[model samples]
Target: MSGRFAPYGWSLVLHAVVVALLGVSLHAPAPRPQPAAAQAEAEPIQARAVDEAQVQAEVQRLRDEARRQQQQEEARRQQLRDEAQRAREVRQREEQRAAEVKRRAEEEQRQRAAAEQERKAKEAAEQKRLADLQKAAEEAEKKRIAEEKKARELEARRKQEEEARKKAAAEADLKAKMAEAQRQMEAEAQKRAQERARQNATLVQQYIADIRNKVERNWLRPATARPGMTCTVLVQQLPTGDVVNVRITRGSGDAVFDRSVEIAVHKATPLPPPPVPELWEREIEFIFEAR
Candidate 1:
């Protein structure tokens, strides 16, 4: 039993030595290839053994640096996103303002168009009203002219009829005068003389009455004149019935009243003609009395 245990112990010692060598190799750095010329010129280089604890500390520092870099990249990405969002908002605000400006401009244009249209419409309406008034005026003028022409024609016709009637009356009077002349020739000379005197007297009375009527028509009585006031006025006239002079033959005591009557007689100039030419006088005396 002792002999079998001794052989087992030797095998264990050899395995233990092999395990230690494997552990050292696992921890060692990989060898780098050197140039042949450098290896020949230099002395034998001794390799420094690696420290496991220091290597572990360096690996941990690298991991920490990598983590910090990742965090910085994330922060940068977030900042870029925020800037993009702000830019998008600014663009939206600008678009809204532009839309508002365009809407206001369009509204102003519409208002101006409406105002212009209304002005034109008013002008057209005014023109139409004026045209209507002018048309009515023209129609009224035409009617007035036509009526005046008709009235003139009627007046001319009436004048013609009046002239014709006067001519016919003159012819009848001429025939009667001729018959009377024949009768006068057959009468005695003394009877004819008496008849002529009577006719002369009648003519004188009628002529005096006509003069009185004309003077009375033109007379303007003075306030001083009384009802019983009377005066005689002497008047001188021409063959054409025009008054040449007027004189007061008698006054009614009031000089102003007498002067007024004299003026009235002169104003009634061109005294009525006598029926008989022989009855006409250059100077005649007439009485003025208030009615």
Candidate 2:
């Protein structure tokens, strides 16, 4: 309903009801006639028809007013009903709009929450990937370090083995050299003693004469000396003018004669001098009969 009509509409209805009530009060029913007043009023027979007509007209007028008032009341009530219906439709429309806004708001909230969840998931995945990469790198580094350590150990072992081999070789060489040197020394000493024993008897005939002189007078041998017979000797001398040797100065066999000659030499230890000191010799040669 229009603002201009809604408030005034009820007020007009109230004013009409008040006016109807006043009309009813003013038009009260006629009272009963008194006998003397009735006789006096009966004397006006000439105006009776006009009075009847006027009364009929008055009754018709009152009936028409009641019909008009009823129509006005019905119209006022219908207007009020239409205004109430319009107000109800307006309220319904507002409520529907409010519901639509609420639904949209709810949808927006859901979308935002879903987006946030997705974002969080993405971030978590990234972090996990980075962590995995770091772990892999660490493992690789560890493997590399382990391999290096193993290689170093192997190198150390190899070095130790090589050192041991070198030391062993050096020791073996030293031992061999020492043994050879000792043998050489022994040979040299023997050679030295032999050289000291005699002036080298280069002439075979002289060597045989020297052997004869060292033999006993009773010892006998063939006149012709052997050829290609050679030997060597080692000796220890006593401080007395006598010599004691493990055996005689070199000999080819004829052992009996060799023993006899050695005995004679021992018995005549303070040997007669050679022709001169220049001819003196610690070694002598002996040649014997041919076999």
Candidate 3:
């Protein structure tokens, strides 16, 4: 029995030492001891139980914070994706706007070029029309000049022909007038010659009167005498008679002169001019002188 009791005591002592060491290590910052008065005021709790409850609460708080952080990271990622999509849309819209502007510029250039070509073509047509009109006017002027020249030539020829006809008519009229004047002069000369022959017959009668006056100078017969004496004589013969009688028709009016005149007459029987055969008696009377 002693030996058993001794072993048991030693075991107890060892166990006690182990329990004290575990308690100190397990609860390093132990709860402070309550005052004697306070100890009686409330029921005492196990230190280990309080400690286990505090540790469980801390662990749960940590898990809740980690879950919140994971939710924030996911939200940020979704926002970044949305921003990138919007940027892509903006870039495509800007490219389309630039293309539209370029197309409008090209269309305007084409319109301006077409308008310029129309203007130039209109100017060219106007110039050609004016040139054609001017050419027509010049041709008309040339035709007028040619007609005038031909008219002048025709007029000159007509004038020349008229002058030639007039000259020929004047020359013929002059020749006819000259022939009429020459005929008139010849007729006048022939009339004058006939008048002169009548005058010559009167001279023969004067010669015979002078012979009868001289033969009756002494005979005073019944005859007439002026201061400038005048006389007449007659002679006759029968068909078979040899002698003819002489008679005086004019004398100085002396009776004795008549006898002397008879003797003188007998001396000059048959006077200077013989008697005409057609007249049996030839008689002559004369004006002895002119006053």
Clash count per candidate: 0, 2, 6
Higher-ranked by lDDT: 2 or 3: 2
What is the C-alpha lDDT profile of model 3 across 1-291, one tens digit per residue?
Answer: 454245445544555654565566577875568798867644544554565455445434444444444454446446656766777777777777777777777777777777777777877787777877788888888888888888888787777777777776676666666666666655665556455434444444444554555455534443332344443445453443222675656654543444455555556544444233332234433322211
Model 1 residue pairs with clashes? none
TM-score for each model: 0.34, 0.45, 0.30
**CA RMSD per model (angstroms):** 30.6, 9.1, 23.0
Using lDDT as the measure, what is the rank order of every candidate, best first?
A: 1, 2, 3
The collision pairs in model 2 are 197-282, 197-283
Model 3: weakest 10-residue lDDT segment is 282-291
lDDT of 2 by residue, 1-291 (tens): 365355455555655655565566457665456598576775564365465455556555555555565566668768777888888888788888877888888888888888888888988998998899999899999999999999999999998989888888888888889878987887887787576545444332353354445443534443433444333333333433245553656665656555654565565555444443444446544443322
Task: Name the top lDDT candidate.
Answer: 1
Residue 184 CA error for candidate 3 (Å)?
Answer: 9.3
Per-residue accuracy of model 1 over 1-291 as CA lDDT, tens digit each: 455245345544544654565578577766566688766533443322233343445444544544554455456557767877788788788877888888888888888888888888988998998999999999989988988888888888878877777777777777777767766665655577678777777777778778877888888988888887888889999998899999998888989888988888888889999897888899978887888
* Cα lDDT for residue 246, candidate 3: 56
lDDT per model, in order? 0.75, 0.60, 0.54
